[model samples]
Target: MRIALIGQPNCGKSTLFNQVAGYKAETGNFTGTTVTFTESSVRVGGETIEVVDLPGTYTLAGTNPAEREASRYLLSEDVDLIINVLDASHVAQGLELTIELLAMKAPVIVAMNMMDEAARIGIKIDGPALQEKLGVPVMPLVASRGRGVKPLFLAALRMGKKKNPDTSNYLKIKENDRMARHRLAGELEREFVKRGDRRVSKRDRLDDFLLHPFWGYIGLIVILYTFFQIVYGLGVLIETPLLAFLETITSQAATYLGEGKLFTEIVIGALQGVIAGLGIVLPYLVPFLLGLGLLEDIGYMSRVAFLMDALMHRIGLHGKAIVPFILGYGCNVPAVMSTRTLDDPKERFVAAALATLVPCAAILSVVFGLVAFYLGPLIALILYLLNIFIIALVGRVLTAMIPEDTPGLILEIPPYRIPTPRTVVQKAWFRIKEFLVEAWPLLIAGSAILALANYFHAADFFNTLFRPITWTLGLPSATGVPLIFGIFRKELSLVMLGQALGSMSFDTVFTSVQMITFTVFVMFYIPCLATLGALRRELGTKDMFSITGLTVVIAMITALLARGVAMIFF
Candidate 1:
């Protein structure tokens, strides 16, 4: 039997899924985590049943791809039962979705999730009365803490047993009953929702200050600054050991090869490629993923999104775009996928294009390596600010170009909670696993291709071919090779840079101004192969090539201008 879980965004659908499935699916306060359907099996009544968790949606009428996907799934997919998770604190909004779901005539068991939070907010739910009114079972649950979950699961099992059930009887409402339904719902809410006796404390005051518009911006900036600081410090702390470990492996491999031409090439080349790629990636990627996972599990990401909504609105995107932008910091592929949350196609396209401007894990890893080895943390922070500036500028341009109306913010801001260690580790592990599964093959293939190119001197050949442009941009001929490889993989640029400039310190090989110019050029260059592939699939080949051509031109112009200024100043 198949039981499908569905709900509006941030309504604890994922949390409930995790509870019943006995698996850890990362639950974030933000919308759109489950872009694709995730399935697991759970044992209930001594029988195994498959449970599917669909992406969160605001309503059946939503135009966003994720929402449309969920709505389509409900209409087309054959399921034994539907478990509709709702936020107890926001029943009015949650019930709107329930009403729509009922219209589909599917057998639904309502789970009013986050009951603990609702009670704290002086809101309550009369499960029995609500069940009687809707003619469907209502179960109150706190999925995060494992509260009232058993009953919810049992109810789902019971509901699933009754196939081809008469849902019409459950949803029998008069055509002119809008006013009566509203009044009934309001009366039930008034009777059941009891005010809590607990008074607001100092921590609540602190929360108020932090959540205020003016102070919230300050807090966001501070949080972002601290995040970078942690990333930098952790990078430095881990780099020396990582380098040592790679060097030991490389030395061992060098000895094993014993200078045979073919063996030496394969072994040393592979070692150099791995060290150049993995060594740089592991340090920053590990910490960054863990930090992000912790923040997400603890619900702080919603606050960040809420704070950034005002700025996002200026770009004709909703506040939820912040989640994708943040995910872009980890990888642009998922970030592009996350753009499915934006209801407007124009907004989705613009968001996907501009999201590419946000540096991903590979770029951040390279930045950390460059900063620690050459530019220092302060300059790294400055580059981060510059990145944000570029993203905002690009967003503004895209918004003006596309000019589509986007929906206003209607997101639920989940209260902050301490992330359990088990939850955090589970989420981090899942993310790391995902990264490895999706990116590792690409990294390995890219490394081998780059090694072959260097072995056959194809890279050198390209450098010579692009000599005129390289000279014009004030970059050494060797820089062209890395720039070309960067189009395939951004991290490859760093690896190639390190290999090409072997034994030469960045400070000695290039002036500080030139290094800065190179970094800026790399930052603005064409999106990597994976991103380009996604673009092609999403926006068509013509649009993909157009964007690629535009990015290349912009990169060249920016590099030239930067180099000109650098030459004049330094």
Candidate 2:
């Protein structure tokens, strides 16, 4: 039996799915669309059953891609039974969707998740009463702590055994109108849910500080500052020894290869790429991805989106646009694809453009591995700040060109939960695996290709082609080739940089001003080829090229200005 898990965003649907699916879940898109869902198989009663977790949707209104995807998958009749995961603390909102699902003519088992949070708010839900009212089994679940997981799935298994379980008998008022269905949801909530004196919980007090108008932004800064500090500290601790080890090996390999042959250069160049990948994954990318996972699992990311909303408006977009920006930190491909969730085309375009500037993990590897390690975190932090300022400025310009009414933010503020180590590690690995699988082999080949190009003296041709950019930005003429390779994968730029410069160590080669300039250029240059494909898929080819052009111009200007500014300090 195939059971589909459905819920609104932050309803603990994903947490519940992960509780059962563990680390082996497979995430894939529907056959022809960018909309993704996760699926896994679980064993229950000695029978293996397939379980699919659909994208989160507020309703079956079909207003957005996620909602539409949810609508399509649920209506397809492919599912054996539906597991409607609901946030027990906020049942009324979830019930609105539930009412829509009941009319869909499928068997459903309501998994009332976050029971602990509901209790903290003094919410008393009569589970059997709700089940009786809806004519579906209602299982209380605290998925985060592994409570009620077995019973929930067992109940789902029992419900799934029936060939065609009827869900329509209880609520015969299957009103098709949206507002009327909403009213029915409220009525059901009123009947089944009770509230007593709300306990003064620590969560409430914590929110008071975290969501405080004055101190909230301060807290965000401190949180991010310390967060990066930890990532940098951990990264450097690992990087120093690893780089020394790799460098020692590279030196030995160079000696063994006897310096001047073409074959030797190619072998050493490939090794640099391999070393760069390892250096990046172990030192910077792993820690960064892990920290990002921890924050997301802890539910702090929602607060970040909320906090960034007001600032988002200044750029002529709403808080929702921040989702793409947050996703951009992991990879620009998904970030670009995620722009489909924004309501306005102009907003989507603007969000997609700005997301490309958010610096993916590859760029983070460059920033932390190179700049943060060589210059200092202070300089690196300044670069991040400047990148933000640049994004806001660019956003204002883009939105002004294609004017539209900015939508107000309508975001859910989920209760903070302690992150689970298993989920956190899984999420981190899920992202890291993308880099390892998709980008590493390319890094190796590209490095060897660059070595061959240099050996044959053809590197000069490519360097000359981009010399205008390097020259105008006050960088070494040699930086041209790496910048070009960067279009394939941002990490390749660093990999190729070692080949182009004929050394792995950057400090001995570039001045502080040169380091700042080169890094700044990489920061804003063309999105990697993968990101370009995503932009093309989402925004079309013309706009993809336009955004690509915009990035190169931004890079040249930003890098030039950075070079001048660095002259004052260093």
Candidate 3:
């Protein structure tokens, strides 16, 4: 049997999905669209079932890709039952989608998620009354804390087994248009939910400080600074000992195998790539993702969007663009995919382009591994600030050239919840698994390929091809191949640089100026292979080429400026 999970954005549908699916779900696109959904096989009530978590949509008939995707999948004959997740605090809006889903005549059950948030504001929901009104089971749940999870799935399981479900009364109400559903939703809310003595909660008061005009920006800076320190500190603790441990093994093996032989070089080179992913990339990446997950789970991310909305306007973007930027820090593929959420095509293009400039976690590994690991955290932080300044300038220029009149940001600010360790770890692992599965293999293969090129004396060709560019930047010509390969995987560039320079300890071969300039260039250059595919699907082939060219120009200009500045100081 199959169950489909559906809800509007910020309605806790995804949280509920994660509660049950955990890290076992696989994310992919539907058969014909670029729109993505998650699915996992789970056993409930002694029966294994497939649960599909569709993209968040406000209405079935909406024009956006996600909305259309949701509508198509829900209407398909394959869905046995529909689990409509509703945000308990936002009763009316949740019912808007619920009424429409019921119209399809699928076996439907309502999962009222985030019930604690509803109660904290003194809002009372009669679940039994709602179930009576909708003519379907309504399950109360707190997904983050795992409350009522088993009962909810068990209810869904039992309902799935019934050939004739109890949803006939809901099917009687005609849900023809958006306005009709909207009205019906409001009517249902009036009958079922009671608003009592409202309390001003601590989260509401905390937002006063977090969303303040002046103090908010200061807090953003401090929070970001502290985040970097925690990740870097954790990375150092692991990376130092891990790299030291690998160095001993690889060195002893090199002497045993005889350093210059082809077989020996291939084995050591491939192992070094594995070493880089384990010792270099993962040290910073694991903690970075974990910290990022905590920020997102606790809901400070929305406050950031609210605070930055004004400043974003100056750059011809809105606070909503911050969504892609935040995700970009984790990986650019999802960041590019997120641009689809915007209504305006021009805004999507502009946001997608600028998001590429936001260094991804792989490029982040390059930053911390090289800059923070060697130069110190202060300079690394400065480099990040400089990258942001460059992105804002590029946004302003792109918006000026496009010259579109776009709408202001209309976004929901989800109430803050105390994060659970289990939820946070699941979120982090979900993201980090992509690195281990996709990029780690490429890192190993690319390292071995570069080793073969070196053993065969073919590295000179790539270096010569990139000679003019490297000569212009006053960097060694041999640095060219790594930069070219960065278009494949950004972290590969860092690893290959270690190979080209004959040391994973970068400071041994390059001066402070060389390292800073090389990193700046890598930070802003072409998007990786996966991100390029996402951009093509989102903005078309022409814009992909345009954005790729734009990044190259931005990279060259920024690197030269950094090179000049570093030379004077160093």
lDDT of each: 0.72, 0.83, 0.83
Distance from true position, residue 541, model 3, in Å?
6.8
Per-model root-mean-square deviation over C-alphas: 4.4, 4.1, 4.1
TM-score for candidate 2:
0.85
lDDT of 1 by residue, 1-570 (tens): 888899987777877776666554432212333356767788887888888888888777776667877888888878778888988877866776676677675688888988988887677677887788787888888888989888877878887888677886575445424454555556656665554556785447767877787897898788877886797688768877988888888777777778545656665765665564465456665676678778777777777877888888776677878867876776675566556656666877778877777888678766776654686887778777877776777778878877756658766666676665555655555555555545454555666676667667787788898788778777778888888888766865677787676734677777777676778778777887667755665566787787777666766776677667657856
Candidate 3 regions exceeding 4 Å error are 32-34, 164-166, 248-259, 323-349, 358-386, 403-405, 474-523, 527-545, 559-570
Structural similarity to truth (TM-score) of each candidate? 0.83, 0.85, 0.84
**TM-score sort, best first:** 2, 3, 1
By summed lDDT, which 10 consecutive residues of candidate 3 come out lowest? 166-175
lDDT agreement of model 1 with the native: 0.72
Question: Which runs of model 2 end up more than 4 angstroms from their true locations?
Answer: 243-275, 320-345, 358-386, 437-445, 471-479, 486-519, 528-544, 560-570
Candidate 2 lDDT trough over 10 residues, lowest sum: 166-175
What are the per-residue Cα lDDT tens digits for candidate 3 across 1-570?
A: 999999988777777787778467887777766577888898887789999999989889888778988899888758889999888888999998888888785788899988987887788998898888888889999887789889999988888888877666773465478888888889888999997665677876887788777887899989877887887788768877898899899989899999899999999888877886686356776787778778877888777878889988988988877878876875676678667767788999999999999997688889998999999999999999999999999999999999978878888887887777776776667556555665566667767776787789887898899898888888988798888877765766788899777899888888899999999999999998667767887888899999999999999999999999999999
Q: Which pairs of residues clash in candidate 2, taking residues 3 or more apart in a chain or in different chains?
A: none
lDDT of 2 by residue, 1-570 (tens): 899999998887877878888578887777666567888999987889999999889989867667788888888857888999999988998998888888776788899998988887789999999999888888899998999999888888888888867665756564578798889889988999997676767777887888788788899889987876887789779988998999999989989989979999999888977886787678776887788778877878778878888899898788778767766775676677668777677888999999998887779878887799999999999999999999999999998898767667777776778887877887677667666665567667767876787789887899999998888877789988888878765866787788788887998777888889989989998998667766876788899999999998998888888999899889
Candidate 1, position 144, lDDT: 84
Clashes of 3: 0
